[model samples]
Target: MPEVKNEHIKAILAIVPEKPGCYQYFDEKGTIIYVGKAKNLKRRVHSYFNKEQDSNKTKVLVKQIRDIKYIVVDTEEDALLLENNLIKQYRPRYNVLLKDDKTYPCIVIKNEYFPRVFQTRNIIKDGSKYYGPFSSVFMAKTMLQMLRELFPLRTCKLPLTPESIANGNYKVCLEYHIKRCLGPCQGLQTREDYDKNIRIIKEILKGNIAQVSNYLYEEMQQLASNLKFEEAQKIKEKYDIIENYRGKSTIVNHSLTNIDVFSFDETDSSAYINYLHVNNGSIVQGYTFEYKKRLDEAKEELLGLAITEMRTRFNSLAREVIVPFLPDVDMSSTVTFTIPLKGDKRKLLDLSKQNVKQYKLDQLKQAEKLNPEQRTTRVLTTMQHDLQLHALPVHIECFDNSNIQGTNPVASCVVFKMAKPSKKDYRHFHIKTVVGPDDFASMNEVVYRRYRRLLDEEEPLPQLIVIDGGKGQLNAAVDALRSLDLIGKIAIIGIAKRLEELYYPDDPIPLVLDKNSETLKVIQRLRDEAHRFGITFHRSLRSKKQVLSELDSIKGIGEKTKVALLSHFKSVKRIREADQEEIWKVVGVAKGNLVIAGLKQASDKIKESKEK
Candidate 1:
C-alpha cells in the first residue's frame, strides 16, 4: 500500500488505546488483509511496526497495511471471540483458512404422513424433525439401517393419502413380499400401525431403545405363543441386531439426555473439536471439525467460533452442553453449559478429546506422507521404541540366506535408508567360505564380509542389522560382529519366518511385538526384501549349474564342445529340443550323431518314467 508509511496510520497508532480488543488491517485497495486480538491493543498494534517480523507472511501483512480499525472488549476472551468472528466474516488474507467447512450428518424425519427417516446434511425449513447432527455419517447410516430392520418402514417415494389409497393409486412392490415393509402405500398396513411404528422410531432415535426392545420382546413372545414361529424368529433377529448395534455404539452404556458435548485439541494454526450429541443414554450424533486460527488467536476464542458455527449449521437445540471449558460468548437463557467433574459425563468429554487428538495425529501423518524425511524419522523412531534399541536405525541392513538342498548357497544384504530400500547399496554374497546349505555359516560369512569392508574403508555403519532366521542364525551373525569388535556398536535382531519371532543375541526369550506395530512391519519388510534378493541370486546360480552338469553329461560334448554347445543353445532343454542339424552345427558333424543318440536316450528315459 502506497499510504502504508503515511501520517494517518502513524496518528492512529499513536492514539491507539490500551485495552483488550480486536483489530483489522486494510491494504491500499481497502480490503481487509488480517485480523488480530490482544489484551493491550496499543502495545500489540504498535509492536507490528516497531519490531522486525521473522515471518515473511507477517512482514508482508504489515507492508500492505494502509489503515487500521479496532473494537474494544471487556475481557480478553471477548477480544478473542470478536477476532474470530471478524476473520471468518471477512476471510482475511493472512488468516489460516479452514478448507473443510464440515457439515454434520443428521437423521431427518420428512414431513409426510409416513415420514422418511434417513440421514441428511442440511436442515431445510420444511415441516420435519431432525434427530441428530451425528459425528459420523457411517454411524447415522448404521442407525438408519437398524431402524429400517426393526420397523419395516416404507422405502418407496410415493405420496400416500387416504384418498390416494382409496382410489388405488399405488401398488405394493417386492418390499412387502420380502417382509421388509408392511405395504403402507397399498393400504396393506393401516395408518395407525404405521404412525405407531414411526412414534416408536422417534423414541429410539432419542435414545429410548430399551422401551422399544421390551415392546418387540413382548410382541415376539405373543407371536410365538400363537405358533407363528417364522415371524417370531424374524422379530428375534431384529432384537439381536438392534441390541448389538446399541452395544457397539453406546460407549458409556448409560444415557446423557439432551446434551451436546464438545472436546478439543489444537495445532499450530487450527483448533479441532469433536461434537457428540447425547440423548437418554446414547450418542445419537457425532462429528469432528476444524477451524483455522487467524492472527494466532487463542484456543478459547477459536473454540467459541466453532461452537457457534456448528450449532447454527446443525440446528442443534440441546438445552445442555458439555464442554472442556466455558467459551467467551453470550449465552441464551434456554441453553446451559457444563464442564463435568466426574462420572459418565466426564467420560464422554474424554472420548471426544481422544477423538480430536487422534484426528490431529492423523492429519500429521498425512502431512508426513508428503515428506519422505518425516516418514523416515517416524519409522526409525518407532523401530527404536519397539525393538528397544539405543539409537535410531538411520541405515538398516538385513541378511537372508538362500540355498536349496545343500547346493549353490548364497546370502543377500539389503540396505535401507530411512525405512526405504536402497537398491544400489544392496550386496549379494556368494558364500565362498561356507560349504553346503549352512544358513548359519553363510550368515556369519556375509556379515563378516559386509562390516569388515565398511570398517576397512572408514564407511559409516548401520545402527541396526536384521538376520532373517531364528536364534541360531542370529547368534552366528552376532559372532561375526563380535569378531570385528563391533557387536556393541550396532543393534542386531533375527526374524523367524514361521511365527515372525524376533530374537536378540544372548537372550533366551524372544520378544514378540504386536503385529500391527510400525516397528515390526518395518522389520518384516526388510526381512522379506532380503529373502527375495537372495532367493533370486541363488536360483540363477542353481539354474546355471544344473545346465552345466546336464550339458557335460552328453558324450560328444567335451569341455570345449560343452562350452560351445551351451553358449549356442543356452540350456540342456534347448539343446534337446533343437533339430539334429542345429545340434550338428554347434557340436560339428563328426560328434553330432553321438550327441543326438545320448539326447534320445535321456528323452526315452523321461518318457518311460511318465508312462509308468
Candidate 2:
C-alpha cells in the first residue's frame, strides 16, 4: 500500500489522452472510489495530483487512487453526459450522486380492445395511458377505487371469451356486486357503454374535467327528453360525483395554466425544499424533499444542484420552474427557470417557501415525539460521516429474520425515512431457497433478492443496509453484495443484541454504542423495528400452518373448501360455532353439506374423548 505520490499523477497524465473523456479512480481492490470528467483529459487528470491545487476533498480523492481508467469521447458535452451516466452506474464514494429514494404508483391504461386500468410502478413500452406517478401506492389505489366507482371498469384477470361470457362461470367480484364494476365478465354491459365510460375516464385523467362534466350533463338531458326518468336520475348521480371534486381544486392563479414553484432552505447540516405543481389554474400536487448534508457550499449552489437532481428524477417537469433565487449557472432549454420578484408569480414562490418552513417545523415536532433522545437523526449523521456519503441517510433500511427451530423462517426489511417509520416501504420475505433456521444464509438470500431486483429495474437503492446479527450476518451481506458487484456501493452494518453491538465487515469486535447516546438509540430503534416486523410475519406463517393442519384432519374438506370456509367466517373458532344452515350459506348447499358432515364427525370425536 504505497502512498499515491506526484509520480502516480504524472503516470496517469502521461497515459491520459487530450480528447474529451470521463475518468475513474479505483482503490487497491478495484473498487471505484471517485469518478470525474473533463474537456481536456490531460489537464483535468493532472489537476488532481497538483500539490498546490489540492483541497481536503481532492486530497481524499487522491489518496484512494491506486489505478485510473478513462473513456474517450468526441466532444465535451458528450463527455459530461457519459460522466453522469457512469457516476449513477457506479455511485463513486466521492461524487455528488443524485439520491432519488421516493417512488409512487401510477394508473396505467393499456392499449387494447379491452384496455385494463391498474396500479403499477413500472413504465414499459407496452402502449399504455399513465395518469400519474402518485406519491404512494395507497393514494394510487384510492384513486383507482374512485375511478371504478364512477366508471364500471373491469378488474378481472380472466381472458375475454364468448363461452365464458355466456356461461357466467366466473362469479362477479365484490366490486361488481357493490356497483363499482358493471360485471363485464358476465356480459352485463355492452361494448358501447363500457367504451363511453373509459373515454370519460381518459378525458378526466388528461385534465379535461370540464369536457367530461359537460358531456355527462348533455347525456342527462337526452335521457330526460326520452322520458327515461330513472336513467336521467342515475345520470344526475354521476354528475354529483364529478361535481364534488371541482371544489377540492385550489386555484393558485387565474392566469397561470401550468407551472411549478420551487423553494429551498438549508441548515448547517440539512436541506429542505418544496415543489408545488399548478395545472389548469389549480394546485394539483405538492412534493417536499429533505436533503441531509453539511452546508459547506453556498445556498445558490445547493439550490441549483437540488433543482437539477429533481428534474432528472421526476418525469412530470412543469413548463416553468419558479425559484426564489437565480443561480449563476445557465439552465437547459427544456425548462424555463425564472426568479419571480413582484407579481402573482412572486406570491406563489413565497407561498411555496412558507410550505417549506411549515414542513421543517412539522418534521422537528415529529422527530421529538418519535425519538425523544434524537437518536434517529444522530445515527443518520454518524453513518453519513463514516461512509463519506454526499447526503445524510434520511432513508435507513434494516433487515431481520425469525424462525422456531428450522421451520417457518421469515425475514423482514423495514424502512425509516426522515426519522419516521415508512411502513409502506416495509417488505417481508419468506425464506425461498434456504430452509432451516440458518440466520446468515437467510439474511444473504433476503439482501440478494432485494438489491438484485432494484439493480435490474434501475431503481434507486437504499443508502444503508442494517442486518440483525454479528460478524457472520455482516459477512453474509458483504458476500451477497460482492456477488452482485455492489459490495462498496452500499454501506452495511449489523446489530447483535447480546452486548448491544454494531458490527462492520472489517472490524472484528462489535462496536457498542452508549445506551444514553442518541445515535445508539436510533440504531436500537431500527433493530427493534426489524425484529418486530420479522416476528409478525413469522407468527402469521405459524398461524396459517396451524390452520392448514387442523383443516387437513377433517374428512371431505379439501384445500378449496377449506379456503372458502375460512375466508367466509375468517376463523376456525367461528366456523366451529356455525350451524348447518350457516355453513351452507358460506360454501353453498352441495359443498356445504360435506363441510357440515366433517364438522359433525370432528365434534363427535371431541365429545367421545371428553366422556372417556
Candidate 3:
C-alpha cells in the first residue's frame, strides 16, 4: 500500500460529500485513471487514501492519483449511469474494459419498396425496421427461412419500377419459375400483393407471429363455413406454419415491450455481466462479457458501467430495465429500474445470471482442461466464501441416524474428499447405550465414538462435519467435539431436511445458501449419502432380527449352527434358497439332515396354521 503524496489530492478529498454520485480519479498530466460510482461519495472516494489495500493493483492506482472529481446524482442508480457515461468518454485506464462482446443478429426489413427481409449484425441509421438482436443466430435464421417458405418474396437486385415493368423490359428469373418467388420483375406480381407479403413479414419479425397465426385460424374457419374447402386448406397451412414458429420462440410474453435485462457476477479480479435485449416478449439479443478490473471495483459499480455501455452500444432506447440491483444511475425520473422479486421478469434475470456464470466457467474450463485440481481448488474456494468458513473444507463428513418403531436403531458416517464421495471411508455404527430411538443420543454417541477413535488412532480429521438433522442433532455433535477438545478445530453444521436450511453453532438464523451454489449442493449430497448409508445398515439389522425370531423356535438347530448358517449364506433368504447338498456342505451330513427336517416341519406347521 502507498499514499498519494500530492497536495491537490488532500484538498480534493477534504470536500468530497456524503452523497450518491460518480467519481473520477486523475493521475499526472490530468489523465483520468479510473471512474467509479458510489452510494456515499466521501466514504468511497476517500477510502482509497485512508485504508491500506491488499490488491497490488489498487495500491498502484492510489499512488498514481493526482486529483479527484465527482458529479452528484439524485440516487445510486443515477451515479451508475453517469459513471458509465464518463468511462466510455474517457476510457480510464483503471476501469474494466469489455472486449469481444457479441452483437447479436437482428432481422432487418429494408426501407426500399418491395423491401428485402434478412438477418444483419449491424444497426444502421437508414429508415429501416429492425427486429431482434436475437439471442441465437440460428433462431433468427429459422424464422427467416420459415417466412420464405410461407411467402415467396423477391431476393433480386432488380429495379422493378412500375413504368419499366409496364414496358415489359424485365424477364422472369429461375426463382419465379420454381414458384419460390413472385415475378414482380416483369409486373407479373402486383405491388399490392408484394406489399401485403412484406407487411406479414414485419409482424413475424416483430415476434408477433402468434397474432398472425390466430388471425389465419379465424379466416380458415370462416372459409370452411362458406363451403370453400380449398381456400380453407390453404389458410390452414399458413396458420400452422406461423404457429410452429411461435412455438419455437423463447419469448415469455407478448405484452411486454422493449426492455433490457442485466445480470452480473464477480470474481476477485473481474466482473462479468449478461445482457438480454427483449422486444415484444422475445429476446432479440443476448450477450455476456468479462471485464478485467485494473482497480478493485465493486460488483454494483461494474454491473452499472457494463449496462450503460451495452445499452449505448446497441442504440437501445429501452426505458424499462430489469436488473439484479438498482445501479447508481441518474435515470430516476426518465427511466424505470425494476428489481423483480418474482414473476417472468425475475426468471429472465435468473436466466441472464446463469448465462454469465456459465460463460465464466467455460473460460476457466478451457484453461484448466488437463489439470483437474484447478477445478477442485476453485470449488473449494467458492465453498469457503459461501459458507464463511475459516478454511476450505476439502475433507468433509456427514452423520445420519435411522430408526423405525424404536427398534434396530443405527447411524452412519459418510466422508467426502475434494467434493467427491470417499465410499471406502464410509462407516456404519450400531446404536449402543441409546434406548427408544432417541435421535439426539444416537447422534451424540456416533459423533463421540467416531471422533474419539480418530483421535486415539491419530487419523486425519475432516475440516467440516455435517449433521443430517436440525438444531438438536447439530448441538449433540457440537457437544462431542467439545468433549474431545476439538470444538473450534473443526467446523460443524446441520442441514434441516424440510427447508434445506443450514444451521451453525450458536447462530439463531440458519444460513440460507442459494440453491444453485456449489456449497449447498455438496452439503446436500453429503447429507443424502449419510441417510442412505444409515438406512441400509438399519434395514440389515431389522432383517437379521426377523430371521432370528423365525428360526429360534427350532429346538435341534443349536446356536452354533445358527451362526454358521448366517455366516455361510449371509442371510436367511439365501439359506432357504440352498438345496439339501448345499446345507450338507456347511453343517455336515447328520446336522444338515436334522436342520432340513426341522425347517420342513416348521414350514408345514406354519402353512397349516394359516390355512386353518
- In model 3, where is the ten-residue run with the lowest total lDDT? 246-255
After the best TM-score superposition of candidate 3, give how far the Cα of residue 47 lies from its true spot, in angstroms: 55
Model 2 residue 535 lDDT score: 90
Q: Report the C-alpha lDDT of model 1 over 1-612, residue by residue, as the tens digit.
A: 122367767767765667776788999999988888899988999988887788998888888889886654445644554454456557888888421344446687888977778888676757677765454677778888888877888878898778998889988999899988988887889889888988988777766678878988998999999999999998899788757755222232223567888888886667888876765434445567677777888777777777787788778898888889988666668779899997568767876676576556655655565575876777788788888889888899999988889888888999998899999999998889877878778888999999999999999999999999999999999999999999789999999888888999999999998899888899999998998999999888887777676555667568888778778987778887889999888777878777778778877888999999
Candidate 2 overall lDDT versus native:
0.73
What ranges in model 1 sit over 4 Å off? 1-261, 266-321, 324-366, 433-436, 551-568, 573-612
Q: Candidate 2 or 3, higher TM-score?
A: 3
Write out the backbone clash pairs for model 1: 134-285, 134-286, 135-285, 135-286, 135-287, 254-281, 255-280, 255-281
- The lDDT for every candidate, in the order shown, is 0.78, 0.73, 0.80
**For model 2, how does the per-residue alpha-carbon lDDT over 1-612 read when each residue is reduced to its tens digit?**
233465544445555567675787888899988877789877888777654543688777777778776655445643554465466557788887432322245678877556778988666656667665453466667767767767778877777666777887777789888887777787887767888878888776554667778988999999999999999988888887777653211222234647877888766677788876665333444556788775477777777777777666665667788898875446666778888777557766776786677556555655555566575566577767654566777877898888888888889999988667899999999899996789899989999998899899997877777888888988998899989998767778888888877788898866766778665677788899999988988889898887766577777667888888888888877887888799888778887777666666877988999999
Pairs that collide, model 2: 375-518
Query: Which of candidates 1 and 3 is the stronger one according to TM-score?
Result: 1
Backbone-clash count (model 2): 1
Write the residue-wise lDDT of candidate 3 on 1-612 in tens digits.
346577667656655667776787888899989988899998998888888888899989987887776654445643554454456557788788421233456678777767888888776758777765454678778878888888888888776677788899889889999998988888778889999888887777655667787778898999999999999998898888887764322333334668999988877777878887776444545567889999987777887798789988988899999999988667777679999997558766876776676657655654455577887888888988988889899999999999998888889999999999999999999888898979998899999999999999999999999999999999999998999999889999999999999999999899989999888998999998898898988898887678786567767778999999989998766776689899999988888888777777777888999999
Per-residue lDDT of 221 in model 3: 99
